[model samples]
Target: MYPTEESDPFCLSAASATRLLTDAPWRRFASMGDSLAAGTGDPSPGYANLGWPDRLAGTLRRVRPDLAYLNAAKIGATTAKTLANQVGPVLEFGPDLIHISCGANDIWRPDPDLAEIGWNLRRIFERAAETGAQLTTFTLGSAFVVPGFPDWHDRVRALNDITRELAATHAAVLVDMWSHPVNSRPNLLSADRVHFSTSGQAVMASELVKGLVDVLRAHPVTSDRAPE
Candidate 1:
């Protein structure tokens, strides 16, 4: 069954999500990078068209009605591209919270330069962190498969490793979806089979909310390191 908030126990209800983020301190939120950041996906039958970032912003706004948000993600953007283009605008936005999604396009072709991709991703993390913003990112889900790429799984695994390493190094909140149970659902992918469907996006948003709630618990607002 599609994970609609109305019926699916797995999906967070509107009030539940709001309650989870009631103490969130972020006012300006910016999302940058590739298609995943853009929330590129097919719409599920019962879900909203909003992508994960938009869905997250909505919840944040519920907590703080004056939330400001910018989603500067482009489809097919590589890590290098995101660093070159998106970073400046995000910095200009002065976001208190930032979400990054990149490197998926970089590994789409054979013989991806994992080293270079990792370098660009590290820079992206560094720049976002420099803004004093709490950073959030997601590992590519295992279900995001591309046919005719013999080493596709290996490539994704390697990229995810880099993402995890950088997220740890930068203290970014990471949603490690590489082997999430949601990926096992039959309706997880869109028609392209590369991006997630709205069902998956909903799951991403739900997980992110949960992750942030945990972060808040560990580092309450009184702490200097608390997410603001």
Candidate 2:
């Protein structure tokens, strides 16, 4: 059941419980998903997209200067396509850490199949796990605030639940955006009211960095080389 406006089921308290990996220097970080992972909303010169992944990569570089980054996220890609196309390159990259943030596009479809979307996501997570990479992901916040999508809150809620469940089952670090108070802020969203603004991306990167820090602290990297 979806929580009411007065209720805060999706709170930051859960994020506090994310067990930290031992402090490790992540060598390679790969991102796979849709525009969110691709960093579409924020444009940069000489770069097609500069979103959260780039931001997170930049932050991670502070500790691991040799960190190799790969982003195979394409605009408009759904979970099924991401599972089919994006996952291969990620596996090929053999990253020590991975981040995925797809399925929002699927939710916007005229008639989305939540069940199939969840299945594809599970496959993607399972396959990524096989590579032995530390994974990170986030859930979507309420979409009711977005204009013309009055009833989308429930759909987004269902999707978020699926994401949370998969993240737990897969032992993936989760940045619970759905519960964050920032989700209710209008300034975080772009003019389109769907994609995040530059500031919003920064905020997301900040949250991801926090999660990554905990993961690194708990699972210290014993090797300086990428996982093979």
Candidate 3:
């Protein structure tokens, strides 16, 4: 009854969602990093089977029927692993738009090295940015908690800070989901209570579309010119 309702958060129809990104110029979209980027989660009652990336691609395809899409995200992938693994394939894909997600797995350990994580992430962003693609990413929601880790909040905050700094430095379109009102919803996460449910995935995709729409408003991308 919640997500199925049009009044619920992120319950946008395909046409309504695509309308917001009518000016989007990206022909090829690729996503890389961790399970969050992979869109792993339990099936939510009122949501589609699609993950955020697929859902996003669907909307993009509506505007550009020839849009090419790739998702190279893996479960349990840390920042270092993402750098070592996914980046090459993503580069090879030669995407015009790239969505990156990581850092959560890096901080899953009891003693995470924030400095190292930042360095790896910076490298990841540098490589992605150098490709001249429109980069997009989102911060983890506050509801994703690791129970045994007493300092979970502190860790997430620190990681979010790093993500924010990188996003600013690279001028990446960012969806700042940290402390978002959606996190308050009881059904936001899956049974694992870690990854987002389909409802959350839908919300993530819609939010990302909105983020791109905002960027297009501030700096419209011309047909001849790539996204700035």
lDDT of 2 by residue, 1-228 (tens): 323212423222222322222234677999999987877664322222447788677656655667799999998999999999999989999998898889988988877899899999999999999888889998886532545666688778888899899899888989887867766654556656678665556557667767777776675656555554
In model 3, which residue pairs have backbone atoms overlapping below 3 Å? none
lDDT of 2 at 179: 69
The C-alpha TM-scores of every prediction are 0.94, 0.80, 0.94
For each candidate, the alpha-carbon lDDT, in order, equals: 0.89, 0.73, 0.89
Query: What TM-score does structure 1 among the candidates reach?
Result: 0.94
> Which RMSD does model 1 reach against the true structure?
3.1
Off by over 4 Å in 3: 222-228
**Candidate 2 lDDT for residue 222:** 67
lDDT by residue (tens digit), candidate 3, 1-228: 465524556567788889988888989999999998998877777678889999999999988888999999999999999999999999999998999999999899989999999999999999999999989999988987788999999999999999999999988989999977889888878888898888888888888898888888998876653355
Among all windows of 10 consecutive residues in model 1, the one with the lowest summed lDDT is 219-228
Cα lDDT of model 1 by residue, 72-98, tens digit: 999999998999999999999999999
Off by over 4 Å in 2: 1-23, 42-50, 143-149, 221-228
